[model samples]
Target: MLHEIVISGFGGQGALFAGQLLAYGALEEGWHVTWIPSYGPEMRGGTANCTVIISDEEIGSPLTRHPTAAIVMNLPSYERFEPLIAPGGVLVVNASLIAQKSQRADIRIIYAPANDIAAELGAAQMANVVLVGAMLAATGALQFETLDQVLDKHISARHRDKLELNKRALRRGGALAV
Candidate 1:
């Protein structure tokens, strides 16, 4: 199956990293994948977004107009993309950062306290990983083990030390789905 996923949030929230991880995991799973990151000029405080496409067949275009799933790390991200989610799509929001809720009835929406969960894990930066965990649970796009492998392979050596903690955050996020 082919799936389009969009992840958005403010810069420094690791939106791009999460999208990259998903795309990398899809590749490891033997799927065709593409990752595209888009952002405004504000750097760390600016809006950052990425589109990831995973398919069993060759991907025609990397650009996604309407995605089948979305991970919104902040209110702005949610407001900007929630309306464009495809019918039957699943939207995962970071409840700790996003104050609003999606009103669409045609899709499934999940709100997780990602920031709080990351804080509890002693690594507030892992908030994005929590969202990724929730996305994995909601969409089943990638396996947790595959995600871990991608993280280990792609994360910078400086941050590689935190791999286990990030994986814990993913597991915690996945627990929310249960």
Candidate 2:
């Protein structure tokens, strides 16, 4: 199976990091994976995104014109990527930050209040992780256990203290998907 996913949001919102976590989990599962990150020049608060491709076979390209799934953390990202999802694909929207509702009928839309959930978890920065959890439940691209492993093995030492919080955010988001 091949799953191409895009994660988009403002810089510093952990969009790229969320994609990296997916890549790491895919890699651990012995799948072929590629991650490409992009961001505007304005840096933090600017637009940032990353594309992650996970497949059982060798991948030929890193770019995808229409992804199989996407996680949009803001209205701008939601507007930009909503139309780019392939038919029958999944779209995870951050409902806490976006005011507009999705109009697409061909794709599955999951509205997750990531920001509010993260705030309740006491770390708004983990909103991205919350979305990742939602993506995990919605797509089943990677196992939840694999994500837990990725968090434990791949997170940097400096951020180790927030590991549990991240896990909680992930669980909260996954709950939304169910």
**Pick by TM-score: which candidate is best?**
2
- Colliding pairs, model 2: none
RMSD of 1: 1.1
Alpha carbon deviation, residue 73, candidate 2 (Å):
0.7
Runs of candidate 2 exceeding 4 Å displacement? 39-42
**Mind giving the per-residue lDDT tens digits that candidate 1 earns over 1-178?**
9789999999999999899999899999999999999955847988999999999999999988899999999889998889999999989989998889777999988889999999998989999999899888988888999998998899888888898999999999988865
- Stretches of model 1 off by over 4 angstroms after superposition: 39-42
Minimum summed lDDT over a 10-residue window in model 1 is located at 37-46
TM-scores vs. true structure, each candidate = 0.96, 0.97
lDDT of 2: 0.93
Clashes of each: 0, 0
Model 2 CA lDDT for position 163:
92
Candidates' lDDT values, in order? Answer: 0.91, 0.93
Query: Number of clashing pairs, model 2?
Result: 0
